[model samples]
Target chain A: MKYTIFPGCLISYRFPEYEKSAKLILQKLEVEFIPVDSFSCCGSQVLESIDDEKMVLLNARNLAIAQELDIGSIITLCGSCTHILKKSLIKLHDNKILKRINKKLRLIGLKFFPKKKIEIIHIAEFLNKKEIFQKFQNLVVKKLEINIAVQNPCMVLRPSSISNLELKDRKIIRNLLTSTGITASSYRYMNRCCGGTMLAFDDSIAKDLGKLRYKELQKSGANILAVGCPNCQLMYSIYQNMLVDDVVPSIFFTQLLGLSIGFSQKDMEIDKNINTEIISNILNNSIKNNG
Target chain B: MNECKECGACTNACPLNEYDENYIVYKIFFGPEKDFKLWTRCCSCFLCEENCPYGLNPREEIFKIRRNSDRSNIPPRIIKYYENIKRTGFVFNIDEYVNEERIEYGLVKLNLDRIKSEVNKLFNI
Candidate 1:
């Protein structure tokens, strides 16, 4: 039951609240984790094209550190981090790649032992585990009745192989949000790409794709958009004000979960969010069911 | 059409195709197309990779093309981001102010000094 938080580059750099909310929930669940800040980037998309081998080597170092620290599970807040780390973990299984990686890893005083078996899981997937889910559901001191439209992480649950989510488990993010006793409804673009990856190359297309989806989200009538990925947060949360007229105020599902678990507004860092004012209004109305 | 099946699933499933009609995903996979600029448009969501009935990875091919393509053809910002990661492990620059902000928010402050040489050996930065 030991875990370590893989606070990815994007979450660590820009969105501290996402990490804070997740840590608070894990703490409340009594799950212990080592705070490992020694690890570097997951080699995100930037390194993948520059040198795919470097990407693998870098992530191998991360996996080696996880194994060194005796971490059983590495909970990631960003989908890309989960995907890259998992992808490298699978690739490092090849004896040849492992040997080459070990050569470099030795310089850094570390080595990859595949037998240790570190599980690289996104927070959404971790929260959706049956035992964890039941524990999380039991902590629900108040059930907010707001209808939430969820946007799933593309990297966290795709390709069916690298992500390791089965067809039935495809709704991990949606299912995790549903536990809050909030109204969970599917929308036309619930599983579509948010073009967050394109921000590296062509940002206009990313914003254009976001505007297209936000327009539909405005029409989805869900009142709030629950997203599990930081890239989606950048689209539907950070850029919501500039993208649409009537913003839906995209929020991390954990932030909403923290409140359902009896945490107050300050606990969730409600003021840090761009659409905090609107969210406060929604929270004001949502708590009427608690009493 | 040789192997793409032109099933239109990839294009239809693509978020970018909705805005730009010329952004046909299968055609890029079908290839003989020369515009690396068009290849830069993908968000790398893997939707097309998942959507393709034949399981061919257009996203991977596009990146292969991007890797082999002339450096001048690629966008400047992406190159800068790649360079930054090579120099510093993280994409965005980390400074005292950034770490101070994290601690103020009740999160752990990052110390890159520990992993600097490790990532340097990996990236040879």
Candidate 2:
């Protein structure tokens, strides 16, 4: 159970906690990770609108690196990165226009052999298996009893072969949470976008859209908003307080899971989180309740 | 000819109304002039298209808005990114950010001269 890890740019800098917690949890589950040292940024939203050719070439280059290392599965922490890489891989494998672009790679001393079946699994997908969930259950030093509202960013579960199996994805996460004695619920707008696409291009619209979703989650009375993607986490955390006048805040699923497993708040870098005191209180209550 | 149902279902189903209420679907078929700006705000999620009873594709109307928006008024940031992509066949600052770690990890470092020759031969660029 080894995978080539693609942390993307946001995870490496803005949200290193996700990278740290993910590595620790996966290792605990006996999943070996080989980080591709020379990996480039997986040109996410920008590539699709800008250069479809270079997007294919760059992504294929990453996949080639994994193939070179004989690692068939690639795991990503960003939903946007997962979506972009998965889409590009599918296109490279299925589209003729992309074949011509691969020929260009040959000139750069890179062979574009697309036969590799590189499965780009999200961290959630990697942790969704029953074996991993059972291992996670065994390792839980504290069981969080608080209600968490799960936010599934659209890019993560859409536009790929996995979209057809989205129902299974929802169940997997719920089952994992339930095994740990935590209560998780699917909120309305659970399968919506987090406005990542419009963030850079139209900041106001992006914020409004994010605020709209946050308001809905707040109305549901969930103590915390559990997120899988770093981009979505950042967006929600940035606007969480502003969106809800007086309500609980959001936290990454990794942060919550790490806390439940007896990882210190400092070790998980929880203090650096942008969300409010309500989340901190929730984490404190989880520790006390489980104790 | 079907009478005006006035059900407002098309207007009610629009996601754009969250941002702009004046963007009515009937505008496309009945208004004096198309308000192209209303269409630009659409995310193409297709909620309106699904809800329309007359089989009107609001998503297509958005495409028309994207195509008809004044070229001079195009956002400079988007235009610049698009142009850079056209020139290099990549959108990101790949050449500027290529580091030793990336090279050692097996990323194919692009040879500018070789890539230029290949693009020229392939697409007659």
Candidate 3:
């Protein structure tokens, strides 16, 4: 019912629509949450690769803040943030590392007491656990009948260990969409990286890799691409114009659910997305047909 | 015998390998030598690490080599992210633009001063 919302750094700054849509939908669902506004970055895969120690310490500080807020769980929409924060929380089990980090935090009057019962969950996990789909079904005024191809971000679903891949958030998302009369499908490279991590290092490779996956997603004949990770949305939506024709534009999975639950396109900030026209048309046609 | 098994599993499973197999093979052999533009093609998917029969972490191996070998070769954007975090205590500094967006969406402007001081003390930056 209540959790601390960690917007991470990138989503809060670069893509505030994710925060806006999530806030609006969660408000409608009556999920009580206070934003972790001062939280630092999650030490993304790039930082982890460069300096594992700093990555652990940085994320430990964020978790300490959650403990400060006295919340048992924190919900994050960015897959990379979820992965990094969850993985770092798991690393705190080592008493030696905990002591080291606590020593550092003590300098700032912040201390991370290991085993504080803090849970870092992806938004998909949070919604699935809270049965948000049933709430959406209860509140739906208009059902948007659209076929969506879902991109399961690697950080969110793969390597199966640190991430709650066993929970199969993909299935939860599909079920959630279906509850609102929308159908979802998977295309090739659904599990492949969307080049989100590599985008900073190699833009060309990142675009090509996303293009490879988008081309396959195009074949799925789904008009809209639904994704669990903000990075996946960033990859597909940012590169929409350069990608193949009829390339399904990406939106956060929650945005689509918000649409079904009676929020208009403006409420979800669909127009701010790079492929606005395509998504706008899809929404318009759905409204026309249902009306 | 190369501490790598030469199993070619990484080459087979990598997404970038689909773009150029010979280039990846060569990068694996000579590494940090030859043209590294091809080396920059790795997308960090870790699929190769997952599929490697020998349990060798080729992804880390390649990234380690790249990190140690070049200064200028490091991506400017990644360096920018580091600088921003070091100076502002977050990956992104709270600029007027971001502050405006936050206010527009009914979210409060983030006060990074506390986190910034904490980061300064912790990292000695």
Candidate 4:
């Protein structure tokens, strides 16, 4: 369970709670984390779309940092980071690309040898690893009774061919919810894009997509939405106010697990959430019921 | 080897395409070679490729265009993000709020000076 952690731009800046909750849960589970410094952005879709080589270089530099640490496997909290890093890793496997990148790396005193490849594991896949979920499931003192819906971001689930992900991540999220005694709500738009990519280009369109998912979750009786990607959480969480109807609070999957592992509301930074009162109410009600 | 029938099914399935069908349609009709200012609109969601009936990944075509396009015409925010990475070795450079938050999380404050030096040596920035 030992690996290097890559907390991409958003988690490090706008949403450090994901890092905090993740670090706490991973520490409790005895999973060793080696933090790599001097890491850059994931070269998100926008960066990649403008100049593919720059994106590749940025991602490769991050991978090289892990390789320098002698860490065989790397885990990321952001789905976009996981997708971009995994894509870069696969691309670097080509001898020509490796040679080209290594030439640039040599200038920085770094080298990416194709012979020694590193395994890129997303946090979802890391937790889904054989019986690990079961171990966490057994530790839940209070199973959440609120209706929880899961948003399977495109990077985490669909376009499976390029993602290079093998785990049934969406099912794992569902199972994680169900095992923790939380009701897993499934809706038609569960697999739909949250319009995150379009948020920067056309916010109206992004909000439209977010509103669609929000309505579906409401129709399914879900009060809280759990997501694994920071971008997805960012979209739905912010869209709550933009929507006129009842809007469910969106939380990171790690934060959902944090509650079961005994992390308090403050520890998970639930207050910083836009719709913090929703989750706080759920926790308060759970306490009242247990009392 | 010729599987694609140019049915535009990929465009029909794309989430971003729903925002503006003409953008994707324009790309498909006239590959990524032309300087389509709206090229940055593609979110890299890969939905269109997944729904493609011909198994042709239009994303690759877009990527080819992006790779060859001039870097100067991209959005200002994206340019700033790249500059931040080159100068600070971070996409969002450490600020007072970020420093305070890092301390709260029990994480070490990043040595911006050291990181910048290392990045300069690496990226020649």
Candidate 5:
């Protein structure tokens, strides 16, 4: 399948490491991915709330880029990006909406042919595909000793109509973690929101949710947290550090899998994550033992 | 006129409801607006739909309400984010330091100049 990177805004601004490691892992897995430039934001929930037509316009531009380049799917790192882009992909399938959006796209010299199909897939779900996982499994060179509580991006699975996930499919992230031979602990409220999106409008309530989630994660005895979305990354890594005294550090699943695939800590950009100095020490010790 | 058992499974499963007992948003969402008790709180996690026994989607119903509600109900901060998107085609400002960071991380620099004008045209409508 020909796939391209969506490069949603959050990853570019807050967490380039996710993009870096994801590219590196995809390279190692022998999956060919194209890098498309001049792509705009997915017009995430914030955009949908304000103007549905404009939201579809921006995403339609990006989708049209894929169609023009003959790319089959656009892989994304953020859950919100996956949701927004896929929502538009489905919306553009309607003949009336496609005509309306195309009127604007023509000005930019772009067009979206809904008949020529394209898909939006999140990185976690992408890696869990059986063939990709088999290739990824062969790359494992380290099983760093640690207990991790995985937070599946809620948007990637819910509102089932858009995400189109079945019960087995929702288990993608957790299953990918366990495959690496690390300890996967079950945390209460693991399936809930990280309150990152809510952090935009309601900081007080966001902290309330974060405090509750961290308590469940800490109580579960997990030493670290792995997430698929940057919203969750920024929340758990940055806000959790500031808001809570006891913190179970967070990393992208790409980073965790990068470690098992024999990429170094620096390769994963672990230092960018605050409150992860303890995690750094664990990796250092694991490396020394292996050495 | 609505099909709700008021099973409270969604409310019980809603983490937001854990802190605020009166925020039975699922109940409000499943019923008519006249039947709604002035709803509050939606983090948009959609667990309410996930937990519903009869496969009803209370979350979408709640979003339908928000999308059509008065502009006054939307927080000013959310409006600011909306403004940012219209201005730059991005949620946050991606300035020089950000581009430098992308280079250091070995990713391509974004050239939104063309895309921004295109977005401006779309927004002008």
Candidate 6:
């Protein structure tokens, strides 16, 4: 199946490895990705504070561009983008205030018909498809054999619309890890937020929340925290170092998957990771313990 | 509305009261002056809204509080950041911190000038 890719801001600029590995994994499964041209930010965190009309217009414009390309579904790498776009789409379809905003969008020559259905799936969800998972299973040349805690931040779970699918996401990750002969330990608060909402407004609170999760995962005896979204990864990484006394490390789930598939840590760009040394130790320990 | 009994069950159950004993949900429901400061701490987890004796969404009430409060009371930096976003369409100066090492990993750099122009045109700023 083909999907129009929306890299969002963070993945496009800050965490490109996510986009790279995402594209690689999707291609390995033969899923076609059509990049949407002339796309703008999905107004993730900004929309919550700014005027609702502006958020609707910006997201609708992107959706309009997707419609222009005749691609109905847009896959996103960032959970924030997915939540924002999905919420905006729902509002555009259900609220008249948003309808007027779409009309205003037409003044800019960007006509947005809210009736068009645009499916926004997180990259993790797209990869979780049985066929894709099977292909991913076949590609694993080396076993990860590591115990990792999965952190699903609030942006991924809030708004309920997008996160409702995440229950299955937890299962998908478990299944993929087991298939690769990895020991994936499920821990409590797996679905808790990383306190990212307060990152900008209150860094101390965000740090405290991050430290809380770090301690929880540390107690779980997981060496690394595997995540799907970059924002979550960034927050966890920050907490692991600046807040939690550098006790545990955080890595993107795709990075771990890429490594287990015999992709070099450098090839996966894992070497550039701030927590690379700790992660390396974990991988080494997992391998040594398994043998 | 039958789902909500107006028993103020959610108000009593709220954790916000622990932070500020006077920060009760009934005060929000009855008082004319809405103190959003009490509600801003809400995680938006919808636990109170979901558990409401009445189907009333307490989260919506918190949102109303946020809307009614003086925008100036918001952290100046966050306010400025939002203004920049609304005016420029891009998160302002986002490219300056785009770690160069990230570019080598096949990460796409956003055309901030293009995003700024688009947002400016849309907002007529």
Query: Largest TM-score belongs to which candidate?
Result: 1
What's the ranking of the predictions by DockQ, best on top? 1, 5, 3, 4, 6, 2
Clashing pairs in 2: A38-B102, A38-B105
Task: Return the interface RMSD of the candidates, in order shown, one decimal each.
Answer: 1.3, 6.3, 2.3, 2.6, 1.6, 3.1
Write down the worst ten-residue block by lDDT for model 1 chain A.
A172-181
| Candidate 2 chain B worst ten-residue window by lDDT | B99-108
In model 3, state the lDDT of residue A245.
69
Q: Is candidate 4 or 6 superior in DockQ?
A: 4
RMSD of each: 1.7, 6.1, 3.2, 2.7, 2.0, 3.5
Task: Pick out the ten consecutive residues of candidate 1 chain B with the lowest summed lDDT.
Answer: B30-39
Q: What is the DockQ of candidate 4?
A: 0.46
What is the interface RMSD, in angstroms, for predicted model 3?
2.3
For model 2 the TM-score comes to 0.75
- Tens digit of lDDT per residue, candidate 5, span A175-272? 88788887789987667878788777677787888888888888989888989999898779888988888899998989989999989888999988
Q: Show where candidate 5 strays beyond 4 Å.
A: A289-291, B32-40
The residue-level lDDT of candidate 3 at A77 comes to 84
| Candidate 4 local lDDT, B4-24, one digit each (tens) | 666777777776666565756
Docking class of 4: acceptable
In model 6 chain B, which range of ten residues has the least summed lDDT?
A: B38-47
Candidate 1: tens digits of C-alpha lDDT, residues A20-74? 8999999988898688877787868777776778888989988898888889999
On a 0 to 1 TM-score scale, where does candidate 6 land against the true structure? 0.85
Off by over 4 Å in 3: A130-133, A167-170, A243-246, B1-10, B23-41, B52-57, B60-73
Question: Which residue runs does candidate 6 get wrong by more than 4 Å?
Answer: A95-99, A161-172, A284-291, B2-33, B44-56, B96-103
Ordering by lDDT: 1, 5, 3, 4, 6, 2
Least well predicted 10-residue stretch by lDDT in candidate 3 chain A: A161-170
Model 1: CA > 4 A from native: none
Pairs clashing within candidate 4 = none
Candidate that would win on lDDT: 1
Instruction: State the lDDT at A282 in candidate 2.
Output: 77
Q: What is the C-alpha lDDT of each candidate?
A: 0.82, 0.63, 0.73, 0.72, 0.82, 0.66
* Colliding residue pairs in candidate 1: none
lDDT of 4 by residue, A147-212 (tens): 888877677665678655544455767777677778877776566677776665556677866776
TM-scores for all candidates: the values are: 0.96, 0.75, 0.88, 0.89, 0.95, 0.85
